[model samples]
Target: MGILQRAKPLSNIGAKQVGFTLIEMVTVILILGILVVGVSGFIIFGTRIFVESSSIDQVLSQSRFAVERMTRDIRNAVPNSVRLRTATGGSYQCIELLPIDSSTSYLELPIYPDDALVSGTVIDNGISINAGQYALVYPLASNSSGVNDVYQASRNKRFELQSSSSSANVLTLTFTGLAQFAEQSPIKRIYFASQPISYCFESPIGNSEVKLYRYADYGYIASQPAPSQMGTAVLMAENVSNNLLLEPAIKLTEQNLMRNAIVHIEPRFSVNGETFKYQHQVKVTNVP
Candidate 1:
């Protein structure tokens, strides 16, 4: 009886020891592996979406800033002073314009058919006139070769200032020399301007991406200067992918008898795998 009881207890213990088989253990592990892969895929997909959206938003904000700045400058440009140029072979594009520093009506000026004078008079409008700023009168046209153009150093339409004096609200402006205006403004308005400004879109050699640069404080030149010939370049924006030969970055429609000057701004910016374009037109509001 004792031996039978001991044998029965041993058989029950052996059965308890055989808890799980290799096949069952592997089946459970396979299920857990599938669940881990599915969860990891979901996490990876969400992370990619977040990264792409952030990149797009960043591009939008930068583009808006660039467009707004350009628009404001174009709107305030000197009358008939906006001009556009593009590379013939496809490397760069630029738009140049003169910004008015101050403007007021003139009381007396030396017009055409009259002898040039060394001084002119204007009704003081509280704006201080300084030397080295150009006085423009009846600036109505732009020339490719700069003949009778505002960019010229010696033109009848504009002259450099020597000095200014104000008394009894009547301001006397002294010219650099004997100066005569080509034509008188219909409204007798005169504009004072500083240096011309140029905005260029350039691509590095062997690169397809383009960038916007602002050139200023450069003195007037009869011929438009390229990026290499400009002043210190200030970076405006980047990630441009427009082809200069096929699609120019800047275009201008000069003001005519029937319409006002319009600047067409079209720049395409690409970031990550996404791209956006601006179809903006800025109208020049100041007239001679």
Candidate 2:
């Protein structure tokens, strides 16, 4: 009877050890599927957010750098040298300026007396000047009494350095047109180390994929040219917005009076189906 009792308990335990039924197995599989789908969705969402944030950061950095570079250049432009141009229907688009590389005092007046006869001018001994460099000569003192007056309109004269005499501290200058300075005038030299720089928007195919270009070596004339020629276009920024009405514009104050320029830049970038925009207003003061 003991043996038979033990055998009956073992048989009951075996019956209780049955594997999972179809309903139970299907329920577990459904729960696993739900967890997998949820985890996958979270991963995808995180990746998308990371990508979008990176894109935004890249656009912001590029736009900020470009604006700051242009602002610095414009602020240091020579007095009364900032020129602005607009497209048809008064859309502001282009700006050109003469950049002042360095300024130094003239040791004395030119050895010669006549403007036409003078070919070389003397400056301070330490001033560094090179051949092919441009110079703007003006009076050091605003109230000085001489042939070279301090008035903004009358004093400044542009000349190209044909050669330099480092030992004698003289710059041999040549005039593109006529020499503007007389020989016995008190003057200072504002060297033009860089060529005339111009910033403008150019579209490759009728306003498609418009890009910002920086042109250099386009001749320097006091008056702004109509449809200014762009020489050696360098890409400043890409993927510029197409709205002509919202492009970069320059508002120049009376050059002879304030010598100020206000630059408005609204750069828009489209990245990963998202649009990013940056707007900056830079007030540039021309210091000759």
Residue 85, model 1: lDDT of: 82
lDDT of 2 by residue, 1-288 (tens): 355444443445436555899999999999999999999999999998998888778766776777788888887766546666667643336777667776665554333344443355555447666666766654232232422222233454555566555555554444444554532323344445546788876554354555677877766544454434554677777766655555543455533433345666666666667676666666655344
C-alpha TM-scores of all predictions: 0.82, 0.68
| lDDT values for all models | 0.87, 0.59
lDDT of 1 by residue, 205-249 (tens): 799999999999988877777878886988888898899888888
- Under the 3 Å rule for N, CA and C atoms, how many clashes does model 2 have? 0
Best by lDDT: 1
To one decimal, what is the Cα RMSD in angstroms of model 1 from the true structure? Answer: 5.6
